[model samples]
Target: MKSSDISVEAKGVSKNYSSVKALDDLSLSVQKGEMFGLIGPDGAGKSTLFRILTTLILPDSGVATIEGFDIKRDYKSIRRIIGYMPGRFSLYGDLTVDENLSFFASVFNVKVADNYPLIENIFKDIAPFGSRRASRLSGGMKQKLALSCALIHKPSVLFLDEPTTGVDPVSRREFWQMLERLKTYGITIVVSTSYMDEALLCDRVALIKEGRVLSSDSPRGVIDSYQNTLLAIWGDDMHSLLKELRSYNEVKSVYSFGQEHHIAIDKKLYNHNYIDSLTQKLEERGERNFHIKVIAPTIEDCYMEFSANKEGYE
Candidate 1:
């Protein structure tokens, strides 16, 4: 992509905390007006990378830019053009909803009234509780309030680190809906999430693990890259079935996915005879009421596959 089309860019970025390498030669870019996701679990260096991009901390090596401004040399300018909502609730607990909003607005040398339209949809939900202290607001309400504060300055880029984490299922759904609406305003949203399912909501996602990127592609692209034949198998005794599947020489990998175990096998080895052989083995092991069927891979399945072969990506 053209440099002008890029909103955020990182090249060989690395960070270390004494002996711990938080980020190891990481590199990725975010396009302007695109909602990009960093999909990884905790300790995967998501927060570390956010801190570096937002100017909260510096990286040990490599270079990065925000809207063409070098993060190291143009931190002040970068700060003026971006909004960051950290994973934790950092607003003042003693302040009321309206008070918190006004405080953040004033910090950016702008009035809440001036940008009221930008945050109206989110603020409207918490308006009735304007008098309530931030600490007293429910999890979902607090999330909305934080998002409103972040957008008060009309930032061109917004960095949300695990915004839906710890919130209810319904609230998570609502938060994603709000993000969808924000894209129309032409804001580049860089969000990090551990939820594999949430990766589908982004324009593209980078699957990270142990301070390395395993894959970076559109959600469908990542799933389509999976090479092994996948199968969803379950039986009356899930624990025993899992063991039996793992013991099979032809099984490449097996992991418990919700109520069933998802198994991957070599494409050449996956056939009708293989399925029949599996059935006979399970039946001989006293397993009854068992079922096996071919299944499409999900984002989580792709993640597991990449993680298993992370050395290739790193």
Candidate 2:
């Protein structure tokens, strides 16, 4: 297939360590110029997949390719075509932001001058502080600098692993905005994130757990896979509401979701009549300040159920 047809393709890949299976017959693919996301919490095999695709490690079995370059055999050309930013802040902290960017640019036989236009927008924000050590920059600035370096070589494919994990909310939002800009350049971008809300930002997402992909589709498609008529119940007494919700025989599953509680009920046993009865029961139990209503499933809800039966994390 052409690069335009498939930016990435993996078939029945597996990797193991002693008795632990880091990846279990996993397979995934991404189209050229598409911003694909891997959504899952830590230990979900995102890093493993990144390493395999980047040619940092060999898969014990199966095949993987980037723009049709076999990961193992065409690694040199593959490295030239892909820019990978790891989950950790791997940039040299003691080096100035400008220095770090220059170094990476040189590594790929490119210069800061060559790809200046590509990173011009993002670099302007931190260029004023260019002389500052990378260690001193705020999380968001460091993130931008790292991204600038990643693009300095103008790689066709980019892999970012949890790029916003430890950043503040504002920084996280800013980082995503940068990604949106990168997408406009028509480059294939694969990013892994632990935040459920971030899943909405992707053109499509793959929810992975314990080394296997549970579902791969557009964000809306994945969320719509949710089967239950979900409900979010909130109240002044959250603890009591949570306790009462899980104790109810009609409730199939209840998990705390930010400010509200997400619950899946057995429709056969619970309807308007059941909710009314449960509300009355709770009020009688001194949990009187709560409301429950039908709601659509969020990405988090779909991931929870989809990965519920997957193998436990290592």
Candidate 3:
């Protein structure tokens, strides 16, 4: 798609829920046919942003436009042009797979036969089990059915809010594959997810936290902005060692990364004093056999740094 063809645009959007600020002057633009991702952890205002963009809720100030239509003023047009799959499984549990799809299609005033070509590849997988109730479907199957229903109306833009959560890794991978294929149909996709790994799958991503946008760019662009050298350290008594490690003057930051701890130090300004001090400190505490070394930063690392930098503003 051309860069000028913006499918989603928001300008200085802000929202509040009584005493809590859900979004703060957040602005973003996404081009048509591009797979854009909104990444953040829980309670980071991701859901609020999705709600506003999908026209489920309105912002307190500023404006959001989808396909050149204002979310509040042109909500009916936007709703007709966009397909939304919510964060939770919202299909009627009492209805069968076919019934659920038929219902959603009817709500959108579209016939399943009209969009069969658009969803056949995915719907075929669930066709044999069409009679089964939605409540009895597995996570992967439920996800596929929901996706099919979302596309039944042939929406120009699709909004998926954490659609892969709770599904197994294999199912998550499959879900992403489906997204890639959708791009070929010229549909813009804006997906909000807490999964760091999923962030890399998008052509471009916006990292959001506490209702504010921290960074926006391609996955590689965001990762490239990470300025710190990260290192993973592991040893026994790690639980107790964490406190002593933080007490070091040379350590800039510390975060848990999978099985090990990602330790940050000012290699430019600080000497091995940080490492030596940590080793010595651990030894004094009877903690032994420690291993520490630098490792390449991941998308998750960039997100941590991005969110940490935002904390200063709060």
Question: What are the TM-scores, per candidate, against the unseen true structure?
Answer: 0.96, 0.95, 0.92
lDDT values, one for every candidate: 0.92, 0.87, 0.87
Q: How many backbone clashes does candidate 1 have?
A: 0
lDDT by residue for model 3 (72-151), tens = 99999988999999999989999999999999999999899999999998899999999999999999999999999999
Model 1, 140: alpha-carbon shift in Å? 0.9
User: How does residue 31 of candidate 3 score in lDDT?
Assistant: 94
Candidate 1, 25-57: lDDT as tens digits = 999999999999998767999999999999999
Candidate 1 similarity to native, TM-score: 0.96
Among these predictions, the greatest lDDT belongs to 1
| lDDT per residue (tens digit) for residues 1-314 in model 2 | 45558998889999987888888899999998899999876777889899999999999999999988999899999999998899888899999988999999889988899989889988999999999999999888888998898889998899999899889998898888888988888889999987888989999999888888888999999887777768889989998888877787777678899899998875566566766777788898888678988888888888877765464541
RMSD of 2: 2.1
**What's the residue-level lDDT of 78 in candidate 3?**
89
Candidate 3 wrong stretches, greater than 4 Å:
1-3, 270-285, 312-314
Q: Which one wins on TM-score?
A: 1
Candidate 2: worst-modelled 10 consecutive residues by lDDT: 305-314
